[model samples]
Target: MNRFALNHATTKFWDQREAVEACARIGAGIGLWREPVAAAGLAATAALVRDAGVAVTSLCRGGFFTGGDRAAIEDNRRAIEEAAVLGAPELVLVCGGLPDRDTGIDTARARVAEALAELAPYAGEAGVRLAIEPLHPMFASDRCVVSTLEQAVELAAPFPAETVGVVVDTYHVWWDPRVFDAIASAAGRISSFQVADWVTPLPAGVLTGRGQLGDGCVDFRRFKTAVDAAGYTGPIEVELFNDVLWSRPGPEVFAETVERFARHVA
Candidate 1:
């Protein structure tokens, strides 16, 4: 399906050029990561994707605004520019978690709002949407403060939909009882839809434990139906972060991911 996409993180060890070529061969869109793009050089990466005729659906991340790090803002601006160069429409933002001292979730969330207010206009100028991604609560203390789709929508409300929006990742929001309602409320503000099943016995880092499509408990059909009902007709990016998958051959992993997506999500 044209709507099925592969997020680069799914094959973390794959060479970026090979990944692009693979997507081209399969006629699938690709979601890219900044590290590999940087390793390949921005202009070169852009040329490779353009030559391969693979649509760049979205960029991995751009936000980490909770600590009041000035460099973070500048880095996000650069990421926006990179997304534009790659023809990606959205730049995913994982708004950072609490600072080291004195602040709690409320303060962290407030800072995210402030950061969005500052970055939204810049993203609009770059023709890239700042997509606020709500990581799971387990990551709220160290990785992200935006922990729910509802919070993401509220944080994005003040900004124009063209400039700021939210990311709907099944792995992060499946546990939220209000997720369906949040998806409906997101409506036109949904900038990206990422899929990754959730598995237990999380690893030491808990960063690469995402399950393959049917191997976990997420209800993919329901999420797909809900997002469609919310008027989101965008690419469905499969973004599993699994160490086991990364240990396999890239082509094998990619093929298996596509088959699983067809069976469980598409």
Candidate 2:
């Protein structure tokens, strides 16, 4: 099953073209980010992947809907269009967190649902599924209100399977007590499955501290087994957001990621 895919965030410092080529060389799929794709020019990036025969499993993001900005919704529509241009079937959405300290989480979560209701049809029409990525609870205050796989699944439930789904990123959900049950419940709703280990003593902002596979406490095989039991037969993307790995050469990191995936995830 060609299950190994590398998410661009893992190699944040690498040039977009070089990263895509590296994935192509290994016959692996890639998860692209919007900023780099825009920097390379959407058409150019699309052509680059097309010529290299690299599949774009999903786009990095397309949400931040709690800010009361009409522009956020417009931006997501554009993201859907970009995913279509890249022949990617999934557009990952990191639903934004509380708008302010005074704003309640319930309000923020409701806004996410409202935004999805508006965008789901557009995504379906463009032949892309909106994958809600539930960031960890640590990010609940400033990054994402969708803080658990269960929340992601529930938010996606009201939409059509082809229109909305959830991302099962181990780094974010591994600590959850009910994660296994959540994965099983996700079943056909899992649009993307990303892996990254969990490490201790987080970095300053806690943004780039994701551990490399086999480096920390995640039980990747358990996750793989559960997802498989739930009927997921798609790519398993390795998406580590770590500063240490970003300092090394892109190929070196990519090679190591493949080795680790074989040892811990595949």
Candidate 3:
């Protein structure tokens, strides 16, 4: 189905070209990362995807605005430009957690809002939406201070729906009891929808432990229904950070991801 997409991180070692080609063959969208894209040369990457007729669903990340400094804002601007070049409408933002030696989480989140205010207009002019992705609460201290969909929605409220949006990632928000309500409120601003399962007994590095669909506890169909009901009809990207999947051949992992998506999500 062309409605499905594969986020490049799920097959970490796969070269970006190969991954894009595979998704192209099936008419699937792709979620690309800034590093690999930069490594491959921006013009080349942009042409490759364009020639292949593949849609770039969204950019992996572009935020770490705890400082609200010029550097962070400039970098995020670059990311928005990159997404625009690749014809990606959404540039996902993983707002940074507490800055080093800084213990105030509230302040970190406030900086995110301030940073968005500075960058939203630039993003809108570039034809890209800044999608605020709220990570699970466990990441509140180090990775993302916006740890709930509600908070993300609130952060995005100030800007136009086209300029600022919120991402719905199952691995990050499935545990919250009010996720459905948040999704409903995100009616005009649901930028991207990502699917990943949650398995218990996290590995030593929990970041890489997101399970394959159907291999964990997430209710994929339920989320799908909720998102659809909320009026989101865009590509559903499968993003898994599992180490086991990354260790396999990219083609193999991609095939498995497609199959699982068919069974659990599609």
Predictions: Cα RMSD each: 0.8, 0.9, 0.8
Per-residue lDDT of model 1, residues 1-266, tens digit only? 67999999999899989989999998999999999999999999999989999999999888889998899888988999999999999999989978787888898899899989988888899899999999999999898989999999999999998899999999999999999999999999999999999999999989999999999899999999999999999999999899899999999999999999999998
10 residues in a row with least lDDT, candidate 3: 100-109
**Consecutive 10-residue window with the lowest summed lDDT within model 1:** 97-106
Q: Over the stretch 41-73, how does candidate 3's per-residue lDDT look in tens digits? A: 989999999999999999988999997678999
**Steric overlap count per candidate:** 0, 0, 0
Residue-pair clashes, model 2 = 0
Candidate 2 — which pairs collide? Answer: none
lDDT for model 3, please: 0.94
lDDT of 1 at 69: 81
Q: Model 3: what TM-score?
A: 0.98
lDDT, residue 231, candidate 3? 93
Over the stretch 162-194, how does candidate 2's per-residue lDDT look in tens digits?
789999999999999999999999999899999
Q: What is the C-alpha local distance difference test score of each model?
A: 0.93, 0.93, 0.94
Clashing pairs in 1: none
